[model samples]
Target: MLNFQNKNFYQSLLNLSLYLFVYYYFVRVVYVYYKLAKYISLDFYRVALFVPAVIFITLAAYHYFKNIQQLKNNIYLNSFLSLFAIIVLSIIYHFIFRLDYMSDDVFSYQIKNLSYSILNALLGFYLYQQLNSNSSKKIIFVVWFFYAIMLLINLNGFALDTKGVSGVHLMLGDTFIIISIVAIFMNINHKILKIISLSAVLILAYLINSRSSFFSFLVVYLFFLYKEIGLKNLLYLFVLMFFVAFALYYFDLLRINKRMFGVFQGHSDGSLNERMEQFKYGIEAIKNNWFFGEFAGQAIVHTQGYRSGQMGAYMHNWLSYYRQFGLVFFVIFTLMFVYAGLFILKEWYLKNTPIKNMLYYLFVFEAVSLLVFRAYSFTHVWLVMVMLYSYIHDKNIKNLSEKA
Candidate 1:
């Protein structure tokens, strides 16, 4: 019932997922070991990722060149325009509206993540080209198996209060994305398997008290499981929620209580005030470069009447990107999703087909995620883009083959 025309495409996607998993672990392992390598001169672990990364990049590049004509079709071409404009504008504002408080750490962070964004896009494009029906099942199986092992590692680390070997130092976000991806895949059947995975993850997410992950679980519930629930189920859900709240309170680990119970509690506590300050600072920082917004990790060329350090506070709010980065870049960001949506839209709605509905709903869920999380610089966004657009590629191949 998977309903895919190209098993090879699916396999490639699974491979990409595996690729991300390996890359992240490799980078983090190297970074961690490199730190303690002073005794043994193990710098090789530091740059070991470049070996596999370079090979995959080269393989992807070859495939990209082989499909240059098809790859540059109108859809990809238009999306590139959006990508190009955004990057160019980001660089321009970074230089033109320079902040004086830019630190070396911030500058390097931005540039490194930017480079990663391009590489992810290219790798995704390459994976998309290698679509075939005979794609390996082994890759998909491997990803799932690896995810199971990683999940255990994460859980163990959480229990022990130890930094995970999942590349905490270098690619924490990627690790989260990979976990979510594999979890989602494993739960595609949406029954006992789904419940088991969700329940385990939900407990872990709550035990760790990550509000974002908790919120993500809630959103996923609404997206995938809402329709199946009834009023009677709501009663059960409330009971479950009550227990969850009690457990969190009993354990004293829930960090977002202020945000959750500010009115009843009658006072601001914990991160609520700090989060508000960051959002406020982000909005104020954008005024420095009203058009293009503040540059990433760069000092404010001239920030008057504001503490220079305040401008650099961590931005946790989803809209902080729009508030801090500028409207033009926001529009460009919006275009990325829109372009992903435009692919093949199916000449017909093709009702009653599980495949069609799944893709449609996936995009809907994706669009909704923008309001909840900002992922403009994240490779996961590119991964989703490739996943969405591959349907278009399959459609194109089918149409051409029929004519032939």
Candidate 2:
């Protein structure tokens, strides 16, 4: 009999990398302890920032190569190719503009981190899709366990508590929490565990105070639960939501964080204004460089950031990428999303089952989340979507084989 429960080396590595990603998110907390050393702290970031990323990518690359015996096809090639094009263009623009300073900016400084994230996401989903039920369940559970550990640390006050990250970094880590909720709902046998798991996700989102993350989880979570358990049972859950919201407000937590919410309040906190300014700056930069936007000179982000102390100093999402990379990059990116969307739809329609149905909604929810968050900048969005589609596609192929 064929074994359906074997965990391969690559699968194990993928699971371990997921854990490391969670741990990397907490590195700033470790930095606080090291900050008191009063000695050289440069090596700390070098180790803390680069090591986890390097390990994850190295493992992921090996895993992808080792999985030749398995079935392939993760989303579409256009997505990956387009991202490659962007990276290339980003590189070319970096030099053509002759802006050496651009290489030292936050994104450039963390290019390896970005590359590692993208590579792991793409490769991880590819391997995860072909996993047998037992193996997939183990992988999901392992990933969820990491999230649970982080939550426990947060509850224990050991977490850095959002001080370590803001902007795009938080967006990257937040997706893991979203997937952890999904994993619990799917894998946990108990009903209460599922609900608590979801509630924990919302609480984490609230604690982070990311408007996009909170709203994305709220929409997807309530919608899914409403479908799963009906509205009558969700009243208590609604109460939970109310209390969480009330606590965040009553304790005046939003004041400390909160971005993109100043227009209606008759105030300018530099968050919302800065994003709008980014659009303005993008428009202005396009006219000067035309091909690569503002990769060079006084028009670049750090310059604008230094001048304005603004929030969104760079392209925020896929649409925003148009501002930096011109129309060609934007069209390629939009096409990639369309192609990925079609694949998910095809798989769901072919299967027409509950799990496949749920995946459809999940993909859509993730799409909305990435649009709100940073789509390409944060790789988890791509990772989660590709993982879901890979499973769906594999099932579709298996079904066709059985039918034939």
Candidate 3:
């Protein structure tokens, strides 16, 4: 007998399928970024992985919607739909009004952005529904473990090329480390596995010499540590870290790339310089079109060197939103996230748990990344935002039911 009504079975299936699809996005973006078409055509993965992922996701979603409660007054759903409407409207406005301003490459990037936005939103909602379960955390950790192992297997292949690029390291390392940190704190049974994953991710981050990623990881880890452990314990741990760092430095074993550490000494790398230039240009663009949006390729058109004439060469922050989507979209999205964050903090204050702490840590990570590191279009940021909002919404509903 097929137990079509079994929630546990469907939830497990959904978790496996959904994360596979999400991580496939990671791999796909890597392939595209590195131009690894000779290794495997993107179309090949689309047919082999994407098709089945979508179909399974659809089946799982059908079960979820059928079994779940009605969305008669779902504030989160309404908020998401409103934000998505703004996204669609902004895209249409750009396409219609800024047609002559955008080159072919710019148009292609916009199309990719639109498609990825929709896909990430759908994934976020599915994970939101799944995450309310007790086992979902374990399932997520297991999936991360699998991906971390795969990364270890292919570590050398993703090493810095002639370009001296560490974007892959920053992306993959930060992704795994944040999850591993949360999992380590939440799932005591999987402590060893989480430690192994975190170690691998740190190794990658160090070897690739991604300073921003290491800094981000340190900040979030310390924040969560302070929350879980008291300030006194954290200070003791800091003293221990200082000794460890001193020992490594004294042994001449801590050989971080000079360029990676140079930022602290006011010496900037080419990439840093480029980002500074983009920031300057982005600020100016914002000033010019403070109320409305600017053209898509205006950053490229205005810049003179170092990623000059590049399609997506813009600020790697929320400023990217203002430049592309205008002040209205930026304000609305920022407010949505800020409100979600505040709501989460309120809930956490009322009742803090390992799982809630993990969610807060994830929120802090994404918030930090978007402020200075990642571009506005980065899909994972949207996923994290939606996940946080979903958590808050679920908690709100639970509280209301309890009162009744």
Candidate 4:
């Protein structure tokens, strides 16, 4: 009995440590970005995030290895194989095109981006596994509390300096927090508390003025309400959306020429037109080098046509992966997305597990939002996609065997 108790205590400690580290990491990133809070350097922030992620990944890897027998029953092997193929192809594209040969900044940025992606992938997989383990409500509550703290910090930042936060940061941060809230709602079966919490989360999303967050909320809510509300309610929602679009157009909120919008529009004089020009240049660049495109490190400035003497540095297109690598790389990258989507749909139609269904919708919503609104090349989006794919693939195999 004493030994069992000690084992339980150790497990609890490990769980708590993981929770706290994740909470701190996410909250700090949100605070720094939204608050316009300064970090010493991108490298410094990367180290801060990467260290805790490495610790978490080590623990998770150990747990998986210890439970290797269970993995034999799962399709993790196939999922890992697919992931490896994608990485190998990416590496080939990197070296063959001499992608990082142009400048030190390009190589450094790519390294940091890759590091963040791997860390997020590991963290997301661990979280997904934990969700399937014990006491989900407690874990979710802890996560939500950290999310709330992060939201408060972001709001405080905006209140202090209206133009401080970038459009991309606002979109990404709010999307992450809102998704966490949605996950909690899905996992927790409490009707009243779930309604209350969800409403609060919606309000928070609205306050952030993140178009992506708003769209995600609409997508998730309508998906949940679709069958029950029938076509009439759907029509009403469509009408509402139409009016909102009209209002945005009338108010000049919707700018198609430039890939920018939101509160920061007024503060920066050249930002709107600059982004538009960058998008235009990106298209031209892609046209010129459609097959192999430019390397990742090329000095592809956005100020080519502008005689106004504005210094443009980075490619604002998150989809710039196509130009950075090539059409071949883009095709492979797209196939991964297609595979993930089809796998999720298959699981949803067959097994129909609540967790799987929620994840499916989340993946769809996030992918669409990324394409429509902002460019998050270095964010946790890819990692989240990988985790979702892995989970759905595993669950599908499990269901098939159970049926057999």
Candidate 5:
């Protein structure tokens, strides 16, 4: 009886770990933390954001002390070393160069922001670890339940109070819910439950009306169907797309919106045009500081007197790394993402993991949509990328081990 109890306890812990990953990566856990912290005090936001970091640090220390044998594993050591190096380098560059924009220019405040970013990345890694665990189904279900609650709250007008309703949040949340539904379909044996789960997700996506997410879902769904339905059916999909485009065009919504379809049309007013102006200025800044570009946070300072409030803000372009960090750093950063993408693809193809293949396809669809929508940074793209890499890497390792 005692042994059985102990097994259940460990299983619960493992399940919680997996849920945390899905929660942290897809849901606005940080935003939720911020909302709760706001009632405590404005200062609490910083403390709240640091909570995950503090916990992760404690876990690392505990593992070092209690699991010394496991600590000696080269894979664990290398991941730590690489992560440490990246964090240190990014910090040095951000501070020495002043790479981000903040209302507070204090070094400690900047450190807090960097810590937040790193904490987010670590949370993403934790999620990856949990998702790959054997008991992932339980974890996925818990995450989905909490996610549904959050969605209900948001829909009912309980805004997170951190940032306003953003396209990024909507997209990431919808993606997670969609993926969770898919996982349920794969793992759950009940046919009726699977159909219900899928139907619920489809309804929820439509109700949300997140144009990018809705279109992305359609694209990926068609891709899946194409694989199942053959070339003749695929041609019909293209024809359908053409008619959809024509209808949207005939209505003048496409021209008036200036975005692909009408998905990004929510902020299509002058805001997008303003972003374009900012992008233009950002390009000019890049040209001017071509070598060791301006510090991260210094752009706001440089253009402080500009009439455009948004222009005197941290530019949204992911390419800002090039403008602020320099070509070398930007190249390295781009290479890292490219390597992650290729690694995901290679593993998916080699291992024939259907889940990983679906995830890779989703990421590819999202990446393309980002180019068209400029909504990547606002969403959980970084977390999603890390999760995809982790999923593919673990699947590949498992396959290789089985073969060996």
Candidate 6:
């Protein structure tokens, strides 16, 4: 069903590559950091990704140049101007105060992250030019399918143990939650397959033991499912689930975190408590250097002692941006996300299309995760942000043309 014309083919390839990177970039990070891939060096992974990205960019640039007039007013590219400006200023600030502000290694890592983000941003913009609801669905599903297969091959089964359940780590839970929710809500004809898939993912989420991901999955799933099946049906389903939960709890079959509910009382599991502590530290760093933000202080804290390397000891939320990239950067990124989210809500209200529903749910998940779970600089976050922006831009243009 994919359009394989010259430009479309290249753009689709770029799209596939970007999705692959987003879905498994965390896997790459884990593998490199843990030295798990004995046959594949970090440099090999870097080169593998970097080379393809460069080639994709080159081909995309050629197509854009060839169709300059048509592609000149790309909303996706323009939307990131403020973000790009902040990035430039941050880089200049770092260079000027390199000695006083940050170490060479930290700076290098940041630069590398920024470079890849920019490349991904470019690819996102290119894909947006040809993107539609159907294509978006295909790209996501295809990448998720392959990633699932990769996990199966590597683990030989689900990775559920005393350490926890994950395709690799907590990251896998996040990815699985998104795709699973989408799959559940999809209007596919095969009811048996859909039910089986949803059931499988629900079990997977439970086994993962990620309170954030499991509850998030339940929230979105139940909310949408209620709308689809109505309140009466939902109540019946809830009653059934309640009895199931009671049975599981009575028999000690439930494996969920015991402290999951303690978050309401400001006392939760260690990981939840640790995230709160990180937020406190992030706030202190921001306060210490309000204007430019205090990466050096955060870096020092992370380096002195942490589970994840210097860059990994973040608050896992938007505060990470506030602590590292300065208030201006935080404000710009926040506004962009907020505006895009509002646009999707509006579109869903007016049209109520399946694509719009998917977008809205995705926005909900990303918004919640970014506020309390996922880090600000996550590659998938950036991709989703741009996708929202492009969809908004496309809708606005279409409305304008219709009016004219």
Question: Candidate 2: global Cα-lDDT?
Answer: 0.55
Candidate 3: residue 144 lDDT (0-100)? 61
Pairing residues by index, what is the TM-score of model 6?
0.78
lDDT of 4 by residue, 1-404 (tens): 00123455446435644453355445455556555345466566656656666766676566656666666555544455455455456555664665322454555555556656555665555456556555654656666666666666656422322245455445444545545643564576664555456556655665555555665665665654453356787689779978987898799875332222443445453655555766776677789889876544124563445322122343554456676566765666666767787777777657545576567666666666556544434455655575676676666668888999
lDDT of 1 by residue, 187-241 (tens): 3455556556555655544433344444554555544444346557756876998
lDDT of 6: 0.63
lDDT of 3 by residue, 1-404 (tens): 01357767666665754565445445553564456676887688667656666666577557647654665356666666676776678767776776654666776777667666655666665665665566766766675666556555554433443233435656555556555654554665353454444445566555545566666666666665566567998799779978998898789866546666777777758888878877888888789889876647333655344334456477888778788777777888899888877877776667766656666767776777778777766766666677677677667768888999
Q: In model 4, which residue pairs have backbone atoms overlapping below 3 Å?
A: none
lDDT minimum window of 10 residues, candidate 5: 156-165
Backbone atom clashes (below 3 Å) for every candidate: 9, 0, 0, 0, 7, 0
Worst 10 contiguous positions by lDDT, candidate 6: 156-165
Candidate 6's C-alpha runs over 4 A off are: 1-36, 61-76, 99-101, 126-168, 178-196, 258-268, 296-298, 302-309
User: In candidate 3, residue 291 scores what lDDT?
Assistant: 83
For residues 242-302, could you state the per-residue lDDT of candidate 2 as single tens digits?
Answer: 7886898788753433243444566666665565666566666666666654432223454
Model 2 TM: 0.68
User: Order of all candidates by lDDT, from best down to worst?
Assistant: 3, 6, 4, 2, 5, 1
Better of 2 and 5 by TM-score: 2
In model 1, the worst 10-residue window by lDDT is: 129-138
Instruction: Tell me the RMSD of model 3 versus the true structure.
Output: 4.7
Which of 4 and 5 is ahead in TM-score? 4
| TM-scores, each model vs. reference | 0.68, 0.68, 0.81, 0.68, 0.64, 0.78
Off by over 4 Å in 5: 1-16, 22-52, 61-87, 93-102, 105-113, 132-135, 145-218, 234-268, 297-317, 346-354, 369-379, 391-404
For candidate 5, write residues 232-276 as lDDT tens digits.
976896799689869977997433323333435454545456556
Better of 1 and 5 by TM-score: 1
Name the better of 5 and 6 by lDDT.
6
